[model samples]
Target: MEDKNIFDMLENTDDELMEDFTGLCPEIDDEKFEKLFAKSEEDYKTRKAEIKRAEERYNTEGDNSVRGVERIRRPEWLRPVMMAASFVLIAGVVIGSTAMLRKDKWMTGAGTSVPEAETEDTTEEISETTEEPETAAATEEEKTVIDGSEVENITISTRWRDTVDEKIRAADDLVTMQQGFISMDYNDFIEFAADPSLDWNGPLPSDMRESEKDKIYYIRVKDEAAESIADLRTKMKDSYTDNYLDNLKDFYNNNRYYTDWAGSGFDDLNEGDMTDKTYIFLEYRGKLYVNSYVKSCAVSSGLGDSPLIIANETDTSFTAFLPHVTPNVFDYNDVSSDEPMVEIDDMYCEEVKFVLDPECNDWRIDSRIPHDSGVFGELYNRAAEE
Candidate 1:
């Protein structure tokens, strides 16, 4: 055969180049190359026959045919793998040396890298304050807090509370005699409710003058209240997330109480301990326990439509005075719990108090207790005619 350029031969169509291809692969040696081809042919025939036999067996025996021949079942990847191995074997022999296909850039003149110096621009270290950066990564938006900014108050001490204890006990005893509304004796409740202190102050207020805004005193906050509300909200969220209690979750979800008080004006101040200036203009609900400031007694709750009242004391704290009641029960010289009592339209009415906290920025409900006997009856009766 006449010598031919290998590059020209490679440029020809594969079919033409492959025709008598063994004639070009002399490095593989004729004997070894022929042996490989024969082996490949034998493998192809064996695989084809096995598949034919399996198909016939399946036709005859259905699903059970697979059990008849495990050895003859060809692995799926075997053909591709064998083809690849045969290709590599032929290429290795034809190429004469593996280095023709091997990459040894580290050991070769062809693999040398350009030896340029790494130049850094030393003009200045651009300060963030002076220059813009190439990439401005987007920051995650901050989540808006669910807050109403409320400060709760709970009255823990008052001189009149002690003076009212005997009335509460006597009223409770009288109610126990009455049918249906029998509260456990004040004695029985002594385990939970401690008796008021003996440090006697003045009597509970009496007369209609206390309820009238013209006669009573009040204080207002223009800016500190808003700041206190913000503090309260942050604290509440921190507390809620820390505990993650379900009831706290409910409290966290409800924004009504704070919303209700947002525009509500100054609170009435009565005669009491007015020692601390910070305690003035403290913040929520009626002086009594078990009340909702957001909704009327009977509006959302299927109960009495009792209106709210606020009674403040000059010495320290306040109470809610019934608007309709002419006499202030607290003012009377010898006021019984029953004298202040009034039956409301509903049986389930309650009262809540937001007494001044030590910080005096917000009011909080540390805890609440329902008025007993005469007091309870008065609150009930005092619910508005609605």
Candidate 2:
């Protein structure tokens, strides 16, 4: 019986041996087959243990099959769902990674995509808004008339009227003589003319030798005053007279002789044509004289009294008075026929000096002498002789 079973087991194929052993063998009966096929508790435990052992062996040797043959079994019904879930999870992970890469690319390109042209325009606009406005230079459009000529070509000196105007404008103030008058003393005028700082082009009234040239200075002042004589008188009344007198005295005492009485009167004169008051006049001898001659008011009312002095040169006293002559009171052409005068022997004097007697009340001698002396020694001598 042992020999027959051995021969039969040896002769049977794999499937056939499994089938015959299951069907006919009494020792390996239906109960045993059922236990193997239907998973009894012990069978189940054994199967689990075998699966565990197989997994351990597979982990260790990289093989999980009987006799090195692969086992084939039908998958469970839920296997497809699990596979689909796994596929979905893998696809989600790949999609999320791709989205992150795209975001990084966008962030990296931000700086390179900015428009340089817009930035430049913005900078230029800001710069232009912060810049200063351009100022127009002085030109012919700003030229003023003087001596019948449009004074376009101006050479500024410290004594020049235009230069004084410029300086006063720069300082935001009005241009009054340091002595507060239209003119200064002969020496003061000379010093002022000689100073490179003073803007001067021609000779001053006191320096003019030719009567015609001398008349220009007077005419200039008269014209200037005519334009704004009312305003000038107002200014004189307000503060110019006091300021001018003090400044004139100081300038005269410091730079020139104290005998320069003409400087004192120059700033004190009022040039109007409607009042019969004392008039301050400039002498050709560069001396200041107060004329008692009456004249019309050339300016407006309420424009306080002109700065006229009532004292002669010998008195050394000063008394304030009102307008006594017109704006152009002493016409340059007027000269007396019989007038006593003195001749100066000193060439260094540049002009002659006339000392009238204390009783002589003629102020024209003073006016004519200083006025002509400024221009020519001959005219100065003639006036001095008169």
Candidate 3:
């Protein structure tokens, strides 16, 4: 039994791994397993291509740290193993990011104004302001952090694989859940976002995930009892994954954008939002819990979403101020992000929009509108007295 023989057996298109793997993974239906495998393989190939392109660009372009990690390409015999590894990674990203999320695309925007929530303690919020000293320079850092005492607990959901597997075993209960999400109003969507118990849908096809979130992803349709931006922010914090701040910082500082503010006005800049932003930030709150990972410097590009722009028709958009991230500041001479902390212009937070859809339909994002805008568009100077 040569090693290649085993690989060849695995690759025997018609009679190969499927029967054995399915025999092993009997939990999933053959159709579903095949679909998932095919989808995962496509994604794997795409990622591999992306990695290759990045490596090529790295060699051809200026050297940078963003391209530091390289996926070890195993011998062809290990293709199946490699595929499984990629699936696990992507699954983690999908499930862990969105508690009950639509897709991995997330947006955080902030500039000035926009704050309200029925759950919000306006009196308390106002009272909290007195503790801070306001300055002319403070105009850009307009966020107020919830005291640790005030925070209940960050709701991190169960692992994606287990949660998904459980859903599959539950006689496709997830499908019903998915259909029910479509009819949610802005407030309902917020509730869904804030809830840590829900997983967007089980064994959901990535295509379904992508299409559903955008199309059915409507928000702010009704003003009555609408969720305030403050309420949204507080709720969103419920399940933020580790290192979210760093991922956000990387997206803000490094994503390719027109940045009319910068002299680097979209010269060879990657267009779209989600890919440019390093962390798609599965909306556990906005939609799912938080999992933050460093973007591919966003220089190499993948996913992005600018929270600066808002949708008011089927949704509402708001800007965010990251008063807690850093002091409001910028260097006119160094708009180009040659260094991490150096290029950071302001203490920014993410902005979000709530989408409304028919509760009976499967949940979806509104793809017609921009899902990508160099991920998390800059808020400009938002810091100020709140």
Q: Please tell me which predicted candidate would have the highest TM-score against the true structure.
A: 1
Q: State which candidate, 2 or 3, has the greater lDDT.
A: 2
Q: What's the distance in Å from true for residue 70, model 2?
A: 99
Question: Whose TM-score is higher: candidate 1's or candidate 2's?
Answer: 1
Tell me how far the alpha carbon of residue 209 in candidate 3 is from the true structure, in angstroms, after superposition. Answer: 20
Any idea what lDDT model 3 has?
0.28
Stretches off by above 4 angstroms in model 1 are: 1-305, 320-351, 358-360, 371-374, 379-386
Tens-place lDDT digits, model 1, residues 1-386:
34566555666444444656657656877999899999999998987786566435423442232133233445889989978976775565445333432332233444455233311111122213121121122111111111231212212223334323332223222211222122121211000111133111212222321232122122222233133433333434321222322233232123111112122122343333221121111242221111111111111111112234333333333443222121321111111212332222211222333344445443333222233224423332222111
User: What does candidate 1 score on TM?
Assistant: 0.16
Q: Between 1 and 3, whose TM-score is larger?
A: 1
Q: How well is each residue in 1-386 modelled by candidate 3, as lDDT tens digits? A: 69888777655353344667677654878999999999999999987786566445433332221223233455897888977976776565455434322221222123333356511544344334422223222432333223221111111112222322222222112112222212233232211111222223212222343433322221322222213333323322222212332243343343222111111112232222122211122222233311111111112111111112221223221112111111111211111222222112332332221222344232222211111222212322111101
Give stretches of model 3 more than 4 Å off.
2-19, 24-347, 350-386
Provide the clash count, candidate 1: 46
lDDT of all predictions, in order shown? 0.29, 0.29, 0.28
Give the range of the ten consecutive residues with the poorest summed lDDT in model 2.
344-353
Residue 383, candidate 1: how far off, in angstroms?
11
Tens-place lDDT per residue, model 2, 1-386, is 98898877655354435666677656767877887777677777886786566435433332221123223444697789977975776566556545654554475563455467755654454334312111112233344332243322222112222322232222111221222244332222110111223222222223122332211122123323323434444443332333343453443333221222122223333332112111123342333232111011121121011111121223321211112111111211111101112111111111111123244331111111122222222222222223
